[model samples]
Target: MHDPATLELLRAGKLEILGRIVEASNATLLCSVELDGVTGHCVYKPVQGERPLWDFPDGTLAGREVASYLVSAASGWGVVPPTVLRDGPFGSGMVQLWIDTPAASISDDEDSGAGSGSAAGSGSAAHREHVEQVSDLVELCPPGAVPQGWMPILRAQDYSGEMVVLAHADHPGLRRMAVLDVVLNNADRKGGHVLAGLDGGVYGVDHGICLHSEPKLRTVLWGWAGEPIGDEAVEMLSKLASLLEGELADQLDEHLTIAEVQALRTRVRRLLATRVMPEPSGMRPAIPWPAF
Candidate 1:
């Protein structure tokens, strides 16, 4: 969990635009936020820069991003980073703490030893191994050659017409994220959104297209479909159901419509009743395009 002070800074701080994330569909800016001698990097997505979508209402993506963060925090999963909707240099937008992954850390410190016969060397080696293992949470492998514990989602021909299978690791953090995605009604849970945090936690990002009233779930996490929901997830969902009846509903209302909030409640109740992981609905595409 992020410290209260850090969240407060994100909510109320001076932002300086460092650069733009060129690959993003929206005007996502890399920024440096500072207040009272505290400083950190963040991503700022101004509302005015959002591209209009046929499905989602214009200028509401920032609110949905904040709402997703709230739900993640309430679930005690800490999957989403600390995010806030506040005015930036461009305009009012969503500002989120930048998560530094193991790969980024390793690249930033070139002198970090990985082969020495010391405690630090052993730790470095472990960190490198973690980075290597998590670098491909979702990937294509030779047909029927899925990793030991990984789950295959689809099999199709690659660019060169070679047969390959798309799969993801059977990881606990990813399982929790899949459940969270169900709750968020996330329409775009691409593999790239899943981050292996340097602090040994999994984080999800880019939640601008979530919390819709309709059933628009699209993700690469169908590995646990039809399996019984875990005990911890059941308890979390029950607590979330109660929270929706009380304070959480009001909080979500600031960002989502009344119908949308109610839909969220109904989804939680339905999950509690079903007690099993959901499968693809077949009404729509189960996974987002460009899966990564």
Candidate 2:
């Protein structure tokens, strides 16, 4: 899907550039176009390596997004689905099915706490409790270690605290997303990636820059730290473990090396042990600062 010719035409045509949202790492847009008289809408992601300097072996940012979608769809995460890219004038271009819905993001507040520098000076017991909570969240990560997965993607207002809902607590999807992040070694799943449709189904987006065999974990949901791995989480972990030796690997083979697959297997095994959360390392110390 990393064809240069197709991409040039799409770039030149500027097909459906409206409603473009600029992310910290890439640009997302709700695009509409007519392909052979068939009208459709798709999300276009043009690579913008403003931070961490996009180092993946491919063309612009679109390819990475497509890769992420491929990996996720293969693993049954049901993230963005990858459409077939084909021959064109500029190079091969990508075409993906566009999903429309009301989406939400997980990020930090600009008003106070953590990133505001108050976290370091607060000496109250309440502050200490918060600090401990933060520490526990870092520890809750899967052991495989994703450097960017260490950041918290959700704020207190983003959860329910009763049953893992928005503005409440850690939903199962949040944990599942975490699992995907750890397995894929995803580093850019911010609040915005977790989108909730009007129908109440939450979907995750933007998975480019994944499949690394390193500790690239980073996110903004630290509320569940120190919380024991619930039965639900364990079941999901087991499901993921089983996937490693089957269809999941076959799907990953396209973009990921065998070493990457093995590394994923190792992460599954390490996370399989109940009651143990991933300890902080690599980029775990960085707080989610709402870049997009």
Candidate 3:
């Protein structure tokens, strides 16, 4: 599931806080971890910093984050990055490997490119290309102008009351993420959580509010709703179902309640039996608010 070396580094490395990710609802720190001459940046969310949620248990968001990573890894999709629950400068926390997206790297280099006219022009073009790359994954567009091959998830009026649609590219990686979200019972699969990594991986992060014992599958990835689950996903689901019966179940129990673990198994089996992407239930809102 995880590269053993990286996992050990996350578990044992000295964490030096680089900055705080204030945008997160919880106290999320961006830190650089070093161990055995190795160094890498990671996001660390200490349990003591978690905001209380009425639905989920207090002080358990960090474990839930790790649990989600476990499920993703066991599913063989690795949609989530390597995450571990460990002691940090603040306290016990969830530490996850930071993935670099194209846009982030471009912004980091903006100052260097500003010095020369030719370099600035090239940088502008590169920035545009990276923006388009991100837009391809998820975007808001005029209701009548959904991109070719993109799936529309919602049609709503913006602040100006103008009609717009939320959609995402019809991509296999995103399809896998959608399926993974269903399994996690993810309550917040916002557009910003779906990252297009510079290394060409589609990753999902911010999984602190997942794996509830109830059906809370809010997401912006409803393009494949009601469609048949593809063969690859079905095969993976079969493997996941098997994993739930043994060691995987044991590992999850450390971070989740017995009820939650059982619920996860049930969800996987249901998906395998139906072989279809689930439609949103009318009982609750199907997408998370502030979708971006």
What TM-score would every model get versus the actual structure? 0.90, 0.58, 0.90
Ranking by lDDT: 3, 1, 2
Predictions in order: lDDT: 0.84, 0.49, 0.86
Candidate maximizing TM-score? 1
Worst 10 residues of 1 by lDDT: 112-121
Which model, 2 or 3, shows the larger TM-score?
3
Model 3 misplacement above 4 A? 106-136
Candidate 1 residue 123 Cα shift, in angstroms, is: 7.1
RMSD of 2: 13.9
lDDT score for residue 110 of model 1: 26
User: Sort by TM-score, best first: what order?
Assistant: 1, 3, 2
lDDT of 2 by residue, 207-289 (tens): 66666676666655444544565665566667767876888678666656687778878876776764455544654643334
Stretches > 4 Å off in candidate 1:
103-132
lDDT of 1 at 6: 68
